[model samples]
Target chain A: MAPTEASERPSLERLLATREIMVACGPGGVGKTTTAAAAGVMAAVKHGGKVLVLTVDPARRLATALGLTGIGNKEHRVPDEAFAEAGLKSRGELWVAMLDTKQSWDDLIARHAPDEATRDEILANPLYQNISGRFIQSHDYIAMERLYEIHSEGRYDLIVVDTPPTRNALDFLDAPERMADFFSSRLLRWLIMPYRSRLVNVATKPFYQIADRILGTEFLGDISEFFILFQTMYDGFVERSRAVGRLLADRRTTFLVVSTLESVPLREAEFFAQELTSRHLHLGAMVMNKVLPEYLRGSEAADAAHTMAEQAGELGGLLSERMGPAHEPLRDSAQVTRVLKEISASFLNFQTVALREAEERDELSVAPEVMVSVPFFDTEIHDLGGLYRLGEQIWE
Target chain B: MNDLLDKKLLFVTGKGGVGKTSVATSLAFLAASRGQRVLLCEVDGKGDVAGLLESPPTAFKEREVSPGLFAMTMDTEEAMKEYLRLNLRVPFAGRIGPVAKAFDFLASAAPGVREILVVGKLCYEVREAHYDLVVVDATASGHIVGLLAAPQAVNSLVKVGLIRNQTDWMLEMLTDPAQTGLVAVCTPEEMPVTETIELAGRVRNETTVNLASVVVNRVLPELFGTQEEEVFETLTRPDVAAELELLVGSDTAPVLEAARLAVTLRRTRSVHLDRLREAIDPSVPLLYLPYLFTRSHGLRTTRQTATSLGEELGY
Candidate 1:
């Protein structure tokens, strides 16, 4: 490797070329999923290897373009024809998969259960059904668990995982540990002991009595039954979760914190980056998406906008007189004035936001090694071509 | 159509960073300014509601942040304690520390336990007639259906628990259009719009709550009409642009380019806005809030949002 390459500032391209895993996460509505897909695309295009993007949910068009629609928990390759259609060629293969939480949970249960009967019983359990399908927090654990499963398979050279939109952004990071602790906790044993032995001790009688009344004895019994069945797979679950934790903290894994320049998402992203650093996880790059253009921040633009807004009528008159004979539309001074005023006012308005974005960028406390900004695209990024366009902006 | 503020409870939710807190705070402000006693609850406990209101951080205990306006942050453990005291008549003073911890663990394991507590507390405020209106800054779009459907989930699972009995009335209040409604907030962007549309469908089919309205925040101003747009195009032509630069005594390209960017942005957003309108039920009103170009967010932004919300509500 060249010395210049070694000393160069870290970029997403370099990060992707080096790391085996990139976890894209931050606040919702900040293009985390799309950015992850773009990064995966860039990796496949620039580096010759198999790259897979594991996204929780994608827009319908993007899903269709990636052939991800109705294909849950299965990785699919993006066809060469699709790349041709997008006017691009990839050096390596690009793959996509959507996280199917319930399917992942069922697979986990099947893998860990002591016997087929126990696996079927747990799958049939109503509480298990609800926990697997309806529980929101279950998503946090299952996503990471699925990633661990896929990574262990060694099918893809690079895996870009888009995390679920969690209530707290850090939930998935703590999920493996929490899952391990949940099965090992003494409370689980205490809560299920009576059901297991059919005896409530004198010291524990009051607690069970209160619980029985509040939860109803039958519900308590059901809960105990569920936990009792779950307890059978405790060892496997704990060991698997610990392995998942190690995988996240591994040197080959890196995190890409994605956010917009807006204050709220930026704050959340900053906090997420700080937490990743404190946890000794690699914060490889920060991708700021949908950022306003730099031209909006130039003093020359502000000066021009100020003058235009203040002297709109005079400028409109001067321009209309000079150009009205050639262009019929400019003949109307009033319309021209309105246009100039609207243009200047719009510029100033966006300038205010642009300047605020600069401040927010400056105020970001946690600095990752590489920070890249994706300029706002006028149209939605819904296909490979659009993704390629976005990928190119941050590739360097 | 029913007036929005006339409803006893309103849950405002959206994808994060789309100004969910602002809409919730503004709705509370609008209701309070109209002399209604409004209790605003933040379910995520982010303290964003308090920050938007320019009030001190709120706890599970409601505090009057303004005249007729009360604010609180949801703590599921505190709610469980209150439920135990009020319904079960459990002695919560002595053993609650440990008992609540144990219940917290159970809640974490149980699918709907934590969600039920949140919905239960909000319903309790309504059932007690403590406030004329209760506005919840609820969970994001992804988790909201689970939260709102918790009662039905608990009801089907628990059969005969105290929670089962509690969910009946809560479901009654939630399903009733006169008493409760959900406002889905979104920006005029691709993901937010898609999520909002998907959320509306889920809230209708999965949960008992009514989709009362969809608030589209950050609708960028349309910079030109057809005739004026032609004029703008003329102004941007190199020859005309150069003359305008000389007339303005500065480079006018950036200013014109900014306008072009703004126009394209608004045009692109209008497509999503149209899709949102077409996807959502026609009966549900779509309220548009203009993008704020303010330097900072605080009470001022909240008040401006409230004013816009008022105008949209035809106040």
Candidate 2:
């Protein structure tokens, strides 16, 4: 695997890739939200047509970078003048949304089951009421379906999303299956067994006996009653999970493994890439965010290192008589060039490994590419106006 | 190799900043060294586990860096997406335009990825019968708990089919101490110590997985009595003007250099240790480590960290 920087690769922008659902995956704090936004914007502005830069629990950073605050699924008209200012035409459009899991779950119930009886039955299902439904349960499957609804509305060409950063950012990748399996499981149903009737009781009695023998079935029995009252819509959940799973696996989806130069984030990205490939998902690029580029030998870092060492030397001498000799090492490798060089190799090594791994994964469809962003400065951005400026760097 | 080969799941975790990534790599290396098929899994997005193993940062794709050490950073959400597609046999599974992105947003509506699902996936990996050790670099405490106990996290939210049952089974499997060993790493620092102890407590409270020893990274050698006084004396020397070359040889300069930085490190670390004393179990003796002479903390530094941790854990 040959390690290469993002700059080393050609900027291949295929905005229509949005026609395929792209999963921008990476570890936390690795500009995934921003890159997804940037990709969405690039797809819309450069490639043409309406693009929906839909974000789910996006970092305020992504919103700030996109020059839009309080942007959700509501199609905000980015005043023609603004797009013009960015040299983008008004011909394309974007719709933004934060995936409200509970809301999405509600929406799915409302849309699929028909009438309050069904919706309530489904929603109140103890099984559906399980922890997986609200967030872990039916949230992801419903949201993934919502993407289709938004797309079907013909409102946008691209829908960019910022996923939650937890568990290697692939929880979204696997949530639907888990949620569906949850709804499909008999555990919660068994919970309600004691409450429902003879059949339910009969089914749950065994578990109760087991519980009684081990941890006491009375408590578990009560929980089972609650479960029965809660998970009445077990069948509905299974149906919905199947529907959404079908939509996600559709050919139009693409998963972009996002990462930074750091080891943890990069490994997480690769894990995402591998998972996506195994599932037969289209992996477009490895968006390496906030990567530190190797600078020239006598550059700012060198100067900064020297100055810091000098100051530290003075501080050490002031602190102790024994510390006077310690300043030598501080001053010796002050430039940080050698260390930087090694880190650079380490960083590039990550890229090489990623690319090679991508190349090997037959299902990924594309080699692991790179998308590097600058390390964020601690400065604040006022609004979407600021996001536009930040977007300039992310796209390139 | 055969010893590790029988192990289906490898849950590698440590106190924050204890070089769990490095230890994960070494274990993978040890497993791989014997030609045992292995995988180094990084659950936290910080996926540098491969760096120490000298492999590219791989995602779900298990990229083989050496003979048998295949590595990957597991993305739980992405895994969730794939799970949906694969298990459910989602038809349009290929073109998930914005689908996963949306899934991600929704997943966040909760605390995080469901622990059971994540752990379930781990179980899946472990049961796959493909790789030997599915080494997982779990999240820092809260995140790990969320990932491992996701089933518990969303115990009330139910859908249908195998996914829900998967969580139950996973929760059950994870609680079986014989099946899983939970290794935790921590530095002697106060925050990490507190977190590690809390983490240990949670592992005990939440699941029955075995709590492996904690690995304290970048541990400093304790300089005692006269040697400490001599170091202090050298640094605080009043008469020496031109930075008295107290260092005579190659090692001397670094020793002196170490002596100089030692004060600040010791002061800060001393406070950290004091705070930690009350938190960590007294029986869990922290493994001491010397600051290595290096331009950067790289493979070598982390490799040593893993070796020390391994020694501590009697790996």
Candidate 3:
């Protein structure tokens, strides 16, 4: 849910000191990767412990923001040069990597399988192949294993992860419980049993016999083989998804949800935050990033220019009431500045309404801190230097 | 005079989080100042075009941002939804919620080229010469080729009215160099520039549109003033020390230690810009937008930014 009052909320700082797994999640282009890394870098530099920043999608922006060439599964030390030019002295530093989902799955199987034979058996299966090897975007639970791996590595003080932007942003957050629920469901259990029983007894398997007769094909053989292979991995995947649900719910694990001060995205943010609560994940903060602060118009010189700006815009009267106090109109430029204040106010009001709706979510929420990251400079956080600048704003 | 300008449309695309918006805005500013009636269009669903415009974001049916400058942020879902409702004349818009959701889901989630229809529609807008100049912010790199290749991707998928006609016309427009120019945006960093150049190659192979230009946004101009040692020495001096108190922000450092930061900040940012220049094409003109003291660039600042472009490009 959206945060109702900052007074009532605890905040990210309070949660960060306590929580282990702090997820900075939202939809694409909302600065998820950079925020996670900046916070990771900032937390490390501030608290004197290494912080890991893991990105999912392979975009250059992530690499440049960390001031690195290319990032992969291996956690590389963020070179001193990366933030050196930003002119800040750092204490501890960020350890960065990108999620190699397919490789991660292979590694998980290699580590967890009962034996190499069972591992081989599972990997050979097509269903396993589909989910593990070819799942276009890996499931949340699958990604969680990667998160858990980084968390357990203990090299970093905290693991700041940028989760893959799921087509449905909330789907990644909600999928684990749903996947586990599907696995634990009785109907699925029944469907799998018959499929498993067929693998052991070909003669008595009615569905197999019926399938071969109707299709004149060996589809059931392939299907049974697929299930048999998946049967070994199914319990583990379900168990892992369940543990993720538990880990995400831990009081110390904070979810700092980020969004713009816009209605639709904030609405999505509120819905996603509520989904976390419904699923029992700990809420840390609802951070409204890129907020537009009020611009008040006052000076006599500015007043005359403001009046002129109002004359030009359709919403000038509203500007006169609210956001104004614009730049001193340069000599001979009074006419051009006309109604500019009103246009600025209209945009500011849109932001105000968006932030207010976000504040309303605090009434039903659990996050201790309801913070907003106000809009400021920089078109894109292109490099680590940009992130270094972005990090300063977190404190200021 | 506006009608006399070259009408070549520029389409900018890069991987997500690349400086696509800035580059597209700069290119539009570049064209507009050149006296083209530039209409910068964003179909990325971000309303980024409006964000770049001096005007506030609204319904986005082409509002004027400046003289000879108009901009619009296309809501793909809204545009496509309206298109479907009006053109296809779906019996009931509400009843087709499931179908609409399914179409969007399948379009986004279905593995291949479900994007052609929407892209085909966008292509139609550009093809129609609705504006003398059209600059599109295409989807991120991963889905863009398949998105651009939607027409060929849909030859067998279906045979329909506007979808078919739009797709065919879009293919023609995109393939015509004189009519279209595709520019990939990148930063000076290795990955953005590398992927940008790589994508340029891909564009040439996949389509015949002119690879107009690649604009690298936010490159630092290396300053050539004080040496590192003198900067360090200047930090230690007493009078200069007290003077630094008001600005050098930190918990650990006192006023005296603040000078230590200036050298690093000044030296490093310049090196980055030099690296960016080395990585990008030397011939492609570089437009430097000075780091603004404020973050959310106001209308005034955006105009300043555009004016800086005008001066640099001599538009």
Give per-residue CA lDDT, model 3, range B267-314, as digits (tens).
544555566566555654445554333334345555666666565555
lDDT of 3 at A180: 65
> Candidate 1 on A122-208: residue-level lDDT in tens?
999999999999787799999999999999999999999999999899999999999999999987887778553535466556667
In model 3, chain B matches the true chain B with a TM-score of 0.69
TM-score of chain B of each: 0.98, 0.75, 0.69
Off by over 4 Å in 2: A1-12, A17-20, A64-90, A117-139, A186-206, A212-236, A294-396, B1-315
Best by lDDT: 1
Docking class of 1: high
Better of 1 and 2 by DockQ: 1
Docking class for model 2 is incorrect
- Candidates, DockQ: 0.86, 0.05, 0.04
Question: Model 1 chain B: which ten-residue window has the lowest total lDDT?
Answer: B88-97
Residue-level lDDT of model 2, residues A63-135, one tens digit each, is 5445566666455544555566656664466556677656666676677564677677656645345443333
Query: Which has the greatest TM-score?
Result: 1
True contacts kept of 2: 0.02
Q: Interface root-mean-square deviation for each candidate? A: 1.0, 13.4, 15.3
lDDT of 1 at B225: 88
Q: For each candidate, what TM-score against the reference?
A: 0.98, 0.49, 0.54
Can you rank all candidates by lDDT, best first? 1, 3, 2
Give the C-alpha miss distance for residue A300 in model 3, angstroms. 25
